[model samples]
Target: MKPSFFSQYWCMVSQGWKADLADKERLITPLLFAITVLLLFNFCFEEVSKGIEGQVFTAELYLTTLFALQMSYVRIFVPDQQDKVFSLLQSYPLNYSAWFLSKYTLALLYSLLVFVPVMLLCGLFFSGADLNIWSAELWLGGLLSIIGLSTLGILLSTLTLKASGREMLFPLLYFPLAVPVLLASVQASLSFLTSVPGGWHWMGILAGFDIIYFTLGVLLFGELVTAV
Candidate 1:
């Protein structure tokens, strides 16, 4: 009998996690890239107004993390696609929803691994531990953005698997669909930084979109990899 969905999901995530760890080069490069971008943003914004600077910081962080997420998942399907392993896997008596969630979980874990550490370094040292910068708002906003980015990453990965010139086509396909997530992440940070009233609305939008994205991926993943 096939393992339960949770069991299979965890098994897949753990294997992917171990593989990523073994490939330290892949992890180091993107992490270094995130740290470098954070440092540059910190220096650039040092002399700006604190209140509005918060808005700019939020926007910059959101955009940078979005790009990093895209890069991290760029080769998400390389193993299965290149080797055609997915076809064989599909023949197993497994719940494919676990497959979608496993990939999403792995990507989200990597995205947060890159994004959070850099943001923390910037927040504590570069920003002098500003109160507004270290609040639940920033972390919560980041969590939402990560969730959205995870599912979106997987969806985009499958979509571009067989397409020509994927390098050019990925961001073209990814960014437009992710505009809402980017906006919500920025606005949520801005609202928290400025103590504005409307950040909850953006948070709600993020939560809704995360649910929608995950649902679609889970429901359609079987077809998505079949060249949809």
Candidate 2:
């Protein structure tokens, strides 16, 4: 029996995600870096926790989430451009939007995989740390933030494909574009960590950013890929 279009698309996405995970060096590097960042923050806040009583731990978690999202952007886009695989992917019959969405979804999933475990470790290390607020809104906000950052990274990667200094170009172009995501994500995370009311506003911003960038990425990716 022939696979339906959605099935075929999902299969392609799953394959892409597996390929990313199978790259041991690339995959392990980010995981290690994330772990190290968490550890460093834990140590730095060890003494400070006495004064703030948990806000330090909360800030550390928030920073980890932000850093994890940023790293995922580089991981998702840079390697594809460096290896010239994205150009090759253009030869396939896959829908451009589907292809883009697949990449974004994979990055989101990978980010969560790395994030949750590291967060758990953080909780274990910091006695006062709380992971109780793992609600639907927090997860949705994180996913949306990942989607926005991933789209921006993909867009910048496309722009830098032919440039002489893609290494330098990527961070310069990517970080500034990601400021809003970082801000909104941090706000949402703080609200979650503190159990504060009215944090969903930042989540709404994240969703808005995702929708805007997803539309723009879909519209522009076809032209960009064709140009390559």
Q: Which one wins on lDDT?
A: 1
Residue-level lDDT tens digits of model 2 in 112-187: 7766776567667765545445566656655666678777877776777677777687778877888888778768
TM-score of each: 0.89, 0.79
Candidates' RMSD to native: 2.1, 3.4
Steric collisions counted per model: 0, 0
Q: Itemize residue pairs with steric clashes in candidate 1.
A: none
- Cand. 1 TM to true fold: 0.89
RMSD of 2: 3.4
Clashes of 1: 0
Write candidate 1's Cα lDDT for 1-228 as tens digits.
658989988987887777777777766676787778777876876666654666666766776787777888876665555466767777777577888888888888888887887677656643642437877977898899889888988988887877899978999989999998888888887888767789889999999999998888888887876554
Best by TM-score: 1
